[model samples]
Target: MPRGYGGTKGVRRPGVALALHFAFADLWHDRKLSVLGVILLAALLAPPVVLHTLQVGLVETWARDLAADLRNREVVIVGEHQVDADLLAALRAWPETGFAVPEPSFFVTTQTARLVGGRGSSVPLDMRTTSPGDPVLARADLPPPGQAGLILSARAAAELKADPGSEISILLQRTPTGGAVERREVILPVAGILPEAHWPGRTGFVSEGALLGFGDYLTFSSDTPDYRAPEDDERWQSLRIYAPEVSQAPALRDRLQNAGFETRLMTDQVDRILRLETGLRQLFGLVLSLSALAFVATTILIQWLSVLRKRRDFALMAVLGMSRRETATFPLVQGATMTAIAAALALGLAAAMGGSVEAMAQGYLAQPTEIVRPNLIPLLAGALGAVALGGLAGAVAVVRLGRLDVSRALRGD
Candidate 1:
């Protein structure tokens, strides 16, 4: 027989399988502590997991919805004076610019046939001219460029009791040279109705030529000292400038401002909303990180207590001729096993909590909330964090076991 050390030679130092077997045996022996550890980990991990899931869903949905309306976010530029054709051309040529349309006449108060047709009520409207491919109009409903008609907003149509193919009369208040106010009435047909989704206000869209012709009528029809001929009016009232995307609005606004135009962007409201969300997420993340760090500390304390309680067993193993490496490795195995079990339980608990959060979000939002399923990033972070804490505890236990005096521990002193 070939004996290597103390007449027992066939076996070398204890390997990983032996360590793992002892680890599982220890877990079964101290099942109560194992269960308590897993419960603590689950409690600590669940809330942050739920919050992370909800935040991911909300931010993604907000960004996607905003992107869908990007085409409609036209930068409106009102000059210090009225905008002119040259400015409109320059804007259309601006970098990242899509379309630039002149809105010379706006907010012309008018009466509809339904209003004068025994309805006895008038509706003030926002009127603007649109051309083909105007971002404001639905592609299928856009009137041809020279069409002489108006497209009413859904609200306007409802109030006026009008529909497509119906006629409406607009009353223009004109002041003549003698300071006499005359009401100029014009009859026009409704081309289409603007969808409620696209209606920012009680607005209407008429073809550019049709609107210019109406302006001409207002200009020369009455001998008014204040009358400005539409053709001679080089200055534009304002411009509706479309950009390729909403993200480009800030740059486009700056460019226009530098070029001597006053501009307003639709993205200002969106940016404000996004900034609020970012701030909330940042605060939440800070709280979560601190909580996680505290949990790690608590885990280290629990591991230290467990190792202290097992000192007698470690000393007995050392006395039985187990090497210092084998004795130290036992607690390491126990830590890894316990941490793995706890991480699994915690993840399951987090998933259940996430479902509840999603249901609550859907009910409160009262709209489609696009929550991502099987979100792995946060879950992985939690698992990695727990394992790292366990690894640190294992290292500490190993070092403590290495320094233990086996004789003193085994002497019951």
Candidate 2:
């Protein structure tokens, strides 16, 4: 009915395009109010964003550090229990198994050994059996296949004054039933040194064959003129098992316990970290829900009041042939635009807050780690959620607009 409401030839302008145009014009006309609304929305949204970023960042940092340690995934088979090849093979075949190596009986695991060309002091060290894929030796070079080399822990190396390319003389002693105590001195080359963080205390890691040989000599006095390697069917007294992931440690431990193996694992530590993450997320969720509800309520009240004040203007539009749907789109578009701008401002504020936290944390930490890592997916989802809340608020205003009596409002009634 109005000249400009429909284009020439009675072709109506696209409703959304026209609504958007009016929305922008109205927002610009009340630019100061719009800007104030944006500031309020951003203030409400920023705290949740910063809190979430911190939670995710700190939890992720802890998780990564725990994962990097590798020991958290390690499952130690306690005491001397016979582990046959069949059982070891079954464990190796398990999906959770990342690495598995057999350890000799406890008696032979520790022995007095001294570096040949250095301090010359014999240090009693626990010798662990290591294979090619051992997680403990991930950073260290593996010993030559068989029994020619050893990797010493930082403490052991420090006490022995040992270094790579040096030699160590280990004394292997055993007494047979009713036989004299036999002692044999064997020399092994130092292949590498393990970091203190990995092995800790006085410890040495040797090949499975070398450990087995030491066991044979100690158990059966097998170091005669002719020495033969042990058979493939030899049963090991213990095993060093590791899971590929921290999450898998619990399942693997449970599986081992179910199979009648007495084992010790860092599952408790992993579980504690996992529980902390869950608790933080739940806490954040509660805070975010409350904050979001307040934001929505405030937004809806603002939009509703704005519509009420502009009832005459909307009534005039209706008289000029603008449909209710087109009028509704005006508020929807305005709400979405304001929300998007507010979300952007909130994200920027969150980032600034996170950076401040990270800088402070870095000053105190020996090893600097990221305490404010922002992930893309969650950030995008948060922005979308803000926009959706805005749309919901606009919908409420639209409901109020739908009930407006156009003729009475236009007549100043």
Candidate 3:
């Protein structure tokens, strides 16, 4: 053995070793109680979990809405037939605007997209085309507008089992160029798939130059007055624009209004999403309040009772020359130690359960989703907090015991 390692000169001091043995001996007899205390302490570590789950669903919904809003850009609305030649020219020259085609005011639709899944088919309708440089929002596939190709929305592509170079058909309502109600089936090669939009379950988009040709429900008539299907002209719908930052949306809207466009900022698409975030915060607070109250009440009550029940054993130790300081500090040590162990167990449980909880929250969301990564701050704080609250309560409850008559304790009366 090395010179100091053998213990003649320096190992742990003998007195320190003896104290360690005695402390362990005392703790050994009470090991079951310690285990029980730890379990109780850990049970209180559940508040943060409930709150974080609510946050996950909310943030998921918020992101999808934000992405959709960004894609929609800004819309420009014209007064009824107010898009005169001069107004059209002025609007057309604006750098941010694209597809300056005339269309109606309110733009929305519900349509079914048919897919040719897993088979090879042939026909003129089977070979569709769109212009190459289509000004697409969040173009997952790069397709140039004006080229003969079709850009499908992510939902559309999925519905059609489509990919680049696949030819597909659009079912539009008919207009009689000659005599009959001709169902126009324009086949375009699938040039690209747009990103998944936050708008759920449906898909719509177009090549830059193309108007929404027509719909299946209405046929164009001449003398009967229902000639062009409603959305064929672009001027009807408000002009949509996008800014680099969300903070710029209001500013851009104001500027456009000032420029004499009858504009109402429709960020309801975005605001409705953010409203979900607010709801989540409120829900989290509700969960937190209930959880915190339970932990505080249960922990303080149990720890304080345990400390009092063990007072006589402690009082005898004091009579045997253990100091008043030792008597006062014992409950603190026991409470903190028990709480610390519970904290460790709770951390393990939280981590194991976090992913599952987050997934559940994501499923509940109405928007884009991201995986949850529970941070360490809550875990660490929870444990230490329990320790503090429990120790304080335990020590306070034992304060009267520390002042007890040694004779009464000794006389067993």
Candidate 4:
């Protein structure tokens, strides 16, 4: 043995070694209670751990959906006055601009003929008419300019009971200025039906030439006997400006607005969704904080009661020349050991359950999703936090231990 190692004087110094020995002895003496403390701590920590993991999954899914929506949308600017072809050309020349197409969508009413055992129905339609160079139709595989046909959204097709190569009659209503409303019918061939995956709305597309034949070029048509040649409505009311990427949407929207048009960008919708996610996370965090406080209070009460019950034993230690400071170290060791073991078990449980919860969440979402586990960092933080809270209880016990009288304690006072 080394020179001073074998003596009680060497091993029982009033420092770490002596403190740890006393703490360990107390724990071994009441090992069942220590184990119970561990189990209780694990239960207390589980809620926040599980909630945090689920929050990650929710945020991830929302982000993916928002990004996809933004990527698929183009920044649109609607002007109070008509947007001229000159303005369209200027916008198309702008940096990061891909397509600057006039949006000639107007509200139209139509009635469908029942086909394939489907019932006839009257439906309101937002009809979009565009020129040759528009990029939107290119993504849908619509044939170039000369081919005249109507493209219907899945919902529109279902309501109309219409399909490609089927002919349908559209009732066009043109309310002339200071005259009775004029109604006309045009039979247009259905070109194709857009899959629901591509568009999630009831809409249809038509050629600008087809709409012009209905005298749709004028905002208001004339039916008076003394007829004036209708001025061409060559003015586009809105421009669908496509950006090179979704990231450029906000800046492009600003640029369009500065140049005198009201703009709506997909980024605005994405920002709102992000703000909502932040609020939800904050709410969950607040709940977790409350849960943590309850856990700490429970630990404090348990430790404080244990300390009071062991007063006689601590007094006996004091009678044997052990200092009050040495006696106080018992709770620190107990709290740390119990909380560490509990945190480890809780983390493992949370991780195991997190994967299953994420899979279920993904199944519910429109897109695939996976949650990010809080992992070792949060587990370590929880363990340390619990130890710190227990240490406060330990400090209270220490004060009581310091004030203890050996004689009174032995007499069961």
lDDT of 1 by residue, 1-413 (tens): 87555764675555556666776788888888788876776666656665665666555445455545644357766643467767667778878687676765553323233434536467776777677678767444555434657788888888787888887777666666877777666666787887766665576777665555556556654332122324534566676777777656667777888877787776565565456567758966886897678667766776777767777887877666677776666776666666767777767766776667667556644256565554688678778877777767777877777777777778766
What's the true lDDT of residue 112 in model 3? Answer: 32
Off by over 4 Å in 1: 1-22, 28-32, 39-48, 59-81, 89-100, 107-124, 138-146, 159-192, 221-234, 241-269, 280-305, 317-333, 337-374, 381-385, 388-396
Query: What does candidate 2's lDDT look like per residue over 256-327, in tens digits?
Result: 888888887854667677777778889889989988988898788878887888889888878867899989
Weakest 10 consecutive residues of candidate 4 by summed lDDT: 222-231
Could you tell me how far off, in angstroms, the CA of residue 406 lies in candidate 1 after the best superposition?
Answer: 3.4
Best model per lDDT: 2
Models sorted by lDDT, best on top? 2, 1, 4, 3
Clashing residue pairs in candidate 2 are none
Tens digits of per-residue lDDT, candidate 4, 46-158, equal 77776766666656465655555534347765544476767777788988686665654343212222233336766666666655665556666765333356777788788
Per TM-score, the best of the predicted structures is 2
The local distance difference test score of model 1 is 0.66
> Considering lDDT, which of the candidate structures 2 and 3 is the better prediction for this target?
2
Estimate TM-scores for all models.
0.70, 0.77, 0.56, 0.56
C-alpha lDDT values of all predictions: 0.66, 0.80, 0.53, 0.66
lDDT preference between candidates 2 and 4, better one: 2
Using lDDT as the yardstick, the better of models 1 and 2 is 2
User: Scored by Cα lDDT, where does model 3 land?
Assistant: 0.53
